[model samples]
Target chain A: MKNLQIFCVIGSLFVLTACRKRLDSFLFNNDNSIIEYKLDSYGGELALDIPIDYLVPNNDIHLFEYQIEDEGEDLNISAIFVGDLNKISSDTVILYCHGNKDHMDHYWPRQKLLSHLGEQGRFGVLMFDYPGYGLSEGEPTEQNMYESTNGAMKWLKNNGLSDDRLVIYGYSLGSAPATKSVGDQSFVLSPSKLILEAPFASSSVMVQDASILNMPASYFVNTKIENAEQIKKCEVPFYWLHGINDDFLSIESHGRTVYKNHSESWKQKNEVPGANHSDVPTFMGLEVYSDSILSFITK
Target chain B: MVLVVGISACGPAKFVEPLKKFENAIAIDVGGPMVTIPDVASMPIPFSSITYGHGWSDKLTLHGSWYTTAAIFGVAQIGAGATYGVWKSKRQKHGISAMLGFNTAFDVYEKNFKFWPQLDAHYYFKYNYKGEQQEDLLTKNGRKRSNLLYVGVGTWYELEGVKAHGEKQQDIVVPMLNIGHDLNWKKWTLKTEVKLIAPFSSNENIVLDYVSLTGDKGSTGVYLGLIRKF
Candidate 1:
């Protein structure tokens, strides 16, 4: 019995170490580093691609960094803008918030695909790496995600893009910042429309789904990214896209609930057949996916 | 005590048959519902519990358990229960037993608490070795050898009236149907069980893909237990 008590104490301490920082850590898969933004030359496991004709000129891509204050720490966030920087004032810009995977390089192909939404370079695309992802400094946290995305928005606002032309797009983990920006009004500029692809309902929903019980999200993680409730406060037109076969985030629970809770505006949802979480854009056929976005934003 | 309510029940069935009066036992159990890992195969969530049981009478046994996995996750979950033998027939080698239990969990970080009430009833058939086989199976301590097969239905009742997002709680009672086998050895019993947990609840919307025999409802849970008698 004495040995058992000692084992319990030691085991509890060891497991407790593994239990903390769940939300901040689990949501971000940003540990891998890239020497450069290789784009098509990345030669990684990316399934999505940008055709040669649609690819932007070398000069059209601008790689830069900006600073942001994240809960008392200064973080340098890396970003890339594809399209003529001078055209920001006249052209509609899609502020693409990438998923919680590796750095900006991993999602460059998707953003490049978005750059050809209606026509080649028809819309300027801005993509950024949240702190702790890619070359950005500091660690990944929910606050850092919001602030890093906000820094990108502020940069666009300063460089002549207006809210009327600013469209925000989030995929998977990126949905937290995109939804919170529009819902909470915490960012420098409001987007004309909001797009979320494979967004989870909330952290609570994740745990509840895992345990098959109404377990509190706080018990497992401290992330309060409740896109379902946040969507209620968003008055802008909401565009939701999810894969019917998304195994990472369920379309029925995560995406559908967020869609159902968008009570304030003209909302549209596209459930692409046979698409999984990361493969939605590729599976939907880039042409069809682009057409859908073009119609939603143009409307 | 926090927002979400009535999340779980005690681990496995405490007793399928009443222990002899004054017998004490300790058991360790491991298992949980199976979930699919996207492109990966479906597997059970590993949950573990340790239990101690005492026989108060020939027909009744009391038991308590500490959820080791929940503790590892920083939730202090504990459960207590009593099993009462409702009917038995030595000649028929079959018996019925009922269990009433409760499980409570506390989040050590947030200091939040939750409680769930549970009930289970099972019918068990005992098969004893005959003649030479029975003599060969008998231990030096004169312990009898037998194998037991059981089928049971269990429920865990959630007390909270509403869900976490203030949605109406449609599933107040979670039901499970279980089938198991117990192999009684000299000083230890091995228990293996398969359960259909929350068969009435829809398994579709949730993030994890559950292994369910019932098309789109509920999930399958598997448990293994080792009990030592003293």
Candidate 2:
């Protein structure tokens, strides 16, 4: 283990020293985005296996791609729409804003549970690619990702998904977009509610104080996205979902700080004791999160 | 509690397609079975493409490809400029040739490693021509070979999960160029070529081999495949 750790440090140095910048597109490791595939028929993270009927050779969920044309290289975005408008009406559209590490394809299982929740809530769903992600255009930045996600909101409206019943669901890095995206262009924001699962206090905090950020999360991170500051200005009900055991973004530091920023006028705060930073959907299940969303939207 | 900080920073050299009902032709020799296979399932629906650049004067052809099992993502390379030809009139052949062609590619080659341009060499040799309409004396025993190469760059781009000085990074400068060849005979084809790769021009350790404990520049990975294009 000691040798492995040493090698890891050496490898990290090489990764930094070898190329002047990002890996070429032709290279597999030079990736900053993802492809999100949904397994909506199930309720939680457990039943991820594709049902035989859905996999009956030649029949499967199709992928829809959209490219965001932004002048800034840091603003290119790609997105995939998983749920069918004809089959389910989620009544509350769940706009899934994902994290930083993996691509959209990495979260299909989690979204599948949300899809299942849509079946229960009678609402539709819309998930898009972040700029610098998967097929989306632009380089990545909190501002660019935020704008791209805002554009997705407009896309959802234009594609028949309205904002009156819209629910902003932010996960990990996605929290930045949801917070920063309150009133941007093409954003229909009379939102039903906002659900931030395992959200960080801010992007800078996630970098400075979070476990993922070893160097004081503050030393190296220059981009500052303060979701805690924006939540207070939101017009709709804002809901916070946190996995108390999260090792990456501490709930007390990031989540609580943001929650405390509400000035007592905000909607509600909910927590699942065991769910880690990213384990909110997988460990807690759609029923729990979906129910909280439904209760807030209905009331 | 020691946390891992991964910060990736690179240069401007590296920057970073599609599918179709590919009407293709091929020669199967080195990739799978030497002799003719029984049918489709016995063969690999190898979806690959190549290109020619610098006109006929440079003799510099570049190319690259990845034929998916088609069990994932989607299926069938569908579009124009898609071809599968056999090289040489023998059961198997390998050589070099030049031509002009248009293609649609689903893969890319990273060009520029620090300051060193990289290349990806590919090899293809067809051993069988399995088509319904074209089963002539050549179908009995003929081969093909070809090479395709492409090169280009990225303007505004980046990468994710890369470590730089013990930290993670999300973007980079990406540029690349590719070249490939196509040799056809009877119903077989052989393809080969190299791609120049370069990543961000600033940092110099993008291509480190820690396992070998050496600092090596980027390289040209060789791809060899075989299929019976129908």
Candidate 3:
């Protein structure tokens, strides 16, 4: 019995160690690679109707790469900023954190729609690829995600943007960095307001959804990006948007929990009907979606 | 995070045929629902359980099981059940059994737990049985050999009034259907089973990619068990 007990303990430890997966690999589907971001030229599935004037030439679209340290190694992070760089100091900027899809090329049209938020180029919208995404170098870790978003914020700050004028918006997986930037005290800059679309509550919620039970997230994943808890510390005016029909992360389990947990003073919620995970913008119609965000920014 | 939780009670039927009075058996089972891992082929999640059964009478057996997989994941899960033989042939070639059971899981993380009440019934047919203890059928172990094939239907009730994050729990009762074969070698039995879990529950909207033959509903589970009879 003693020998059997020892074997059982060792076997349990081995199983525990082997079963855990770094959820970033599964959560972030950053598989596609591109030599250049062919924004309008590359026809992707999801698109919004933007006026021809709002295209690349009319907007000051800057495609640049910034450097960040990932575990002591220097990695290049790719970014795209829309609107006039010269007016960044005076303009309110929205940093668009894209979801866990392929790359920025797939999200270019969405950011283009944001560029026309209040009026064409009224607010500079900046979006970047997380590490191992698109043209960015190094593997995509949860730490690297926060660091990359911080790197983008630092770049915007270097170009004369301030916290009060910075608006951080995250969708789906991007909610991790966006919530962290505002909620985490150690973060470089806290944005004036926070916006999340179809945000998942936490890794544990995902595990619960998968199991339909209160199974611990540590069983299968080590990523502890709990946006629900983070939103409690976020005192900024919060804007929560979710699709009623979000199948990947249920609105009730993922989005509503995050929205409800925000103990902050000012908050707004938009529960769109007939919208899935990635189609909230298109489902709400481009003009309506853009106008809704404008109202939040001005509020 | 597609950890297969719905297959939490998956193991061989506690007893296809109840043992004679005072007999006992211990079993170890492993396997679970199939899930398609991203960039990897579909496979079973390998949930495991250890069960012990004791015969109280010729017609009834009591059983309990510890969920080894859940324990490994830091969740304590256990189940208890009783099987009553409803009918049996004079030659012991066929039998019918009914079982009632419950499995509960508790996690220390948030002090959260859940209970599922279960009911199952099985019909079994025994074949190629040798009466003598010295008879060797498939192996050289000098043990009486027999084979039992059983088909069963079961359902587990979700007792929680609310789902994760206060969502009204819609699926209260999940149904399952299973078919299994047990090879008996006197004091040893090897069991293999295939189950259709939640045959009517929609697989859509869940993060895991379940390989279900029931169109868009339900998932298939596979299990293997070894039993030592005393």
Steric clash pairs (candidate 1): B1-B113
Model 2 share of native interface contacts: 0.00
Residue-by-residue lDDT tens digits, candidate 3, A262-292: 9977999999999988888878887788888
Instruction: Give the lDDT of residue A267 in candidate 3.
Output: 96
lDDT of 1 by residue, A1-299 (tens): 99999699657644753554333465666744676677767767553665667677888789999999988878888899999889998878999988877888788888888888888788899999998887898888888889999999999998999889999999988898899989998899989899999997888777676555666776666777899899989999999999998866889768988999999759999998999888887788889999999999899
Shift of residue A132 alpha carbon in model 1, Å:
3.7
Instruction: Give candidate 2 regions above 4 Å deviation.
Output: A1-62, A72-76, A86-91, A118-121, A183-190, A207-219, A264-266, A282-286, B1-230
Q: Which stretches of candidate 1 lie over 4 Å from their true place?
A: A1-24, A30-33, A47-52, A69-73, A271-285, B1-10, B36-42, B129-137, B141-144, B199-205, B212-217
CAPRI quality of model 2: incorrect
Could you estimate the TM-score for every candidate? 0.86, 0.45, 0.79
Worst window of 10 by summed lDDT in candidate 2 chain A: A21-30
The local distance difference test score of model 3 is: 0.81
Which one is best on DockQ?
3
Q: What are the candidates' interface root-mean-square deviations?
A: 6.8, 16.3, 4.7
What candidate 3 gets wrong by more than 4 Å, as runs, is A1-24, A32-36, A41-54, A70-74, A263-266, B1-30, B36-43, B48-90, B94-123, B127-145, B151-177, B183-190, B198-202, B211-218, B225-230
Estimate how well candidate 1 is docked, as a DockQ score: 0.25
Error of 1 at A25 (Å): 3.8
